[model samples]
Target: MIKDRQLYKLILSILTVIVVAMIGLQLVSSWTQPQAQSQLNLYESDLLLQASTWQETNDAEPGTSPLLENLWGDSDPVQQALKNYQKIKTSATLQSGPTDDPEKRAASEAFVNELDLRLGLLYARSGQVEDAIATWTPLAEAAPSPGNQRAVTAAILQGLWSDPPQLKPQAQQQLESQLKGWFRYQSLSQLYQLQQRQETLTTLRSQEHAAAEKALTRLAAVQVFPAIGGLTGVGILIFWLIQFAVKKRQSLPEAASTAPTIEPIEAQADQTPNTPQELAATVRWPVTTIWQVMVVWFAAFFCVSFVLPVVLYVAGAKPETFGARGQAYLALIQYSLLMGVGFSILYLSLKPFLSQPLKWLPLRWQGSWFSWGLSGYLAALPLVIVISVLNQKLLQNQGGGNPLLEIILNSHDRFSMGLLLFMVAVLAPLFEEILFRGFFLTSLTRYLPMWSAIGLSGLVFAIAHLNLSDILPLTVLGCMLGFVYTRSQNLLASMLLHGLWNSGSFIGLIILGSSVS
Candidate 1:
């Protein structure tokens, strides 16, 4: 037994060392997290353009209300899109750097060239031909060569737009021979169409009016469900407010705390024999050991800090190389493994008392679990949204968000969507609620006030995500989740609430991602 205890200490010490390194990894990786602002900008621009189109079409009628346009204020989506592009241009310029690897250096150069190419198109389309020329000039100055397709294309572009239309004889031939493709929105054929002469914005707008209408139709189609959801939330809030007033604020009161024993065996109170047991098969063991907590932490952080990095390094995988569907599959597998490992560790620590019970956690489905979860979700909407809007402004689209948002947004196929929904809505809620509310908060409640325990657990939950941008809002969200779980005495209630919250976000990202694409 002493030997076993020493071995446990050795394991714990190693985990402590790993935890220190994991903390460092979190801090370093946080800086490189994908920003949410760029995606928001695109979605917002599309929404504005569609709204503007609707306003123009209806304004011709005698009594058309300006309600929609008024709500969004004086925003010109086209200009907003242009400004966003300029910001992107500036950001890409800042990130450009020297590289020692030939492939990396070539990739960097190609990226810059592509950005310039696309930006030049935007400039020309906006009737700034001079700006376009300037944009393409750096690439254009490079000597036309077989390997330098971008330079050759740039030279050809300059020849088409130059005042006197001067060019080497081989320049035109080089573009056709060397360059094959570019961005979907801008390419060689697109430039060629603009070659002979510049078209006025008025003429181009007329040409794109049909496409704009189609985009608007799509935008409106995708937004209908969310509009209904928001309205439903508002209705639910109103009903709850009425109940609060009529019942003197006890309409949805918190449930009585049911914290269990967490003392050492010798210090514990005697229990009745009527307790459920089958030869100690159903013993309720307190998973409150420091070692147990350390193991749980180790499982999570060790995977993130060491396992993930090693796997990616060995596989030579980079974030850019991943598609949404691929990431979804990976997330499903990784989280399944993580949660399985954590629960297994906790279960095994019970040793002689180990046994599978009907209910592993404080999840009671026989009562008002469903209603509690739904109410919590609805009540949470307005407050969470207000904070979220302010959070977005405070962040100014700079702080990183969950990479899953970006991944799920870009995915639409049935299999990938299902995988994502299951992982997020089902898997995440089950594991997180079981760990945080079922174990952590309940254990804390044995010592602290219910509210205090909830608050601390909520804070920890928010920080666990490792997103600075999400910390405040998620803290609020986590508190609501904890409150719901505590009141219902059902882990399922909190899991449902968590699932609904994530499911809502998932839908929104999908709509925005689909519309933008």
Candidate 2:
């Protein structure tokens, strides 16, 4: 017992030393690197000029569209343009105060109107017609100034006429109403008559019919599967909730009648193996010791996940060039080092508390490992699909994209792709499972019920990624990992499931990038 206690202390000391060393290295790197270049100031004229150039060079090839390039490429001129437009519009809105000088107020409003017109045009040219309409609709409707209304109306008309005609009846009616209102307000009867031409309405109706037929055909091809999958998931959840409520109600009566009593020595004997060797082989450390191990485990996790990224950022190590293999190599090295350090900390901290540390760590292979892993993988597929669809819709609504995924897609090369595959599919699965499912879930089970422990561990696992957008889906995945680990009592089962999940995503990314290229 004395030796065991000393060994535990020594293990903790070693883990502490490793963590401190990592922090020191990060600090040294941050201090040694040179400062980054200052950002350039961009104006509306510059952005418009850039947009014009991009549009001129835009290719119809899958990945060659200037808008896509700017969205996913290293130097994002289009995003910068959008940002500048937003900043100018915000400043103008704030500066146009009721008490301000008349000249200043007029200048502010003028700039805001011009900026909105240019922004609407840019969005239309970039093939975002909805966004263009969204930009111009309010300006055309709410602004009382005739000049502002005219400028916005012209831009909206130009956008509607430019491409794939905006032929939806609602869109057309809304625009026509705004146009009629503007014409009546300004007494521009000639302009209104031209817009009301029968030929124009006939052409727009034809375009709308064609577009609707194409959309309906495409929707008919694969719409049924998603509807069925969504309904199935909802049904399963409802059934489970009802069953849980019924079980709880039934259990209350049993709990009220039963009185707890001590078990006989024979019953205790039956729970354990007979021989000392067998007892040593099967015994696990007390739950308290597992919790103690987690303190060190999480410390190492934070050091890598948070501190290391800050160090890399300050060190000017971020790669600026798309498809730069050097960045891939750097990422692999960073991930490897971090995983090694974290695993060492977990293993060392937990070892002394168990008689057979490897078995107690649940590292031993089980006969049913493959079966459990396969089942878990199969179960994860529907959940992954549901979450991915929801996330895509959310991103589309926000007009946002995933920077990390964009980087990965842009950085495609033979060596870099292979390295990414290994890091994501193999290293990530092994180390992440060991930390989250093996250690964290086990530790939580010491104090909480098994299901509650699984939930809390899953939440922590999601939080560890440090990505708010990914938390919900990642938490769902983590819970699945925990369930597999608990059911199989084998870490390898969870690791296998994790590897399969990541491998599928990595392969999909590669395929998508290839198609785009």
Evaluated against the true structure, the overall lDDT of model 2 is 0.54
Model 1 residue pairs with clashes:
none
Please report, as a residue range, the 10-residue window in candidate 2 with the lowest summed lDDT: 251-260
Task: At residue 455, give the lDDT of candidate 2.
Answer: 81
What TM-score does structure 1 among the candidates reach? 0.70
Candidate 2 residue pairs that clash: none
Which parts of model 2 have CA positions greater than 4 angstroms off?
A: 1-292, 305-323, 363-366, 384-403, 515-517
lDDT by residue for model 2 (42-84), tens? 2222322332332323334445554334322455445556665
In the range 226-329, model 1's lDDT, one tens digit per residue, is: 55565676788788678779888653332233334532232122221111111112224543453466456655756654586578768898646767777777
Q: CA lDDT of 112 in candidate 1?
A: 67
lDDT accuracy of residue 432 in candidate 1: 87
What TM-score do all the candidates reach, one by one?
0.70, 0.49
lDDT, candidates in the order shown: 0.63, 0.54
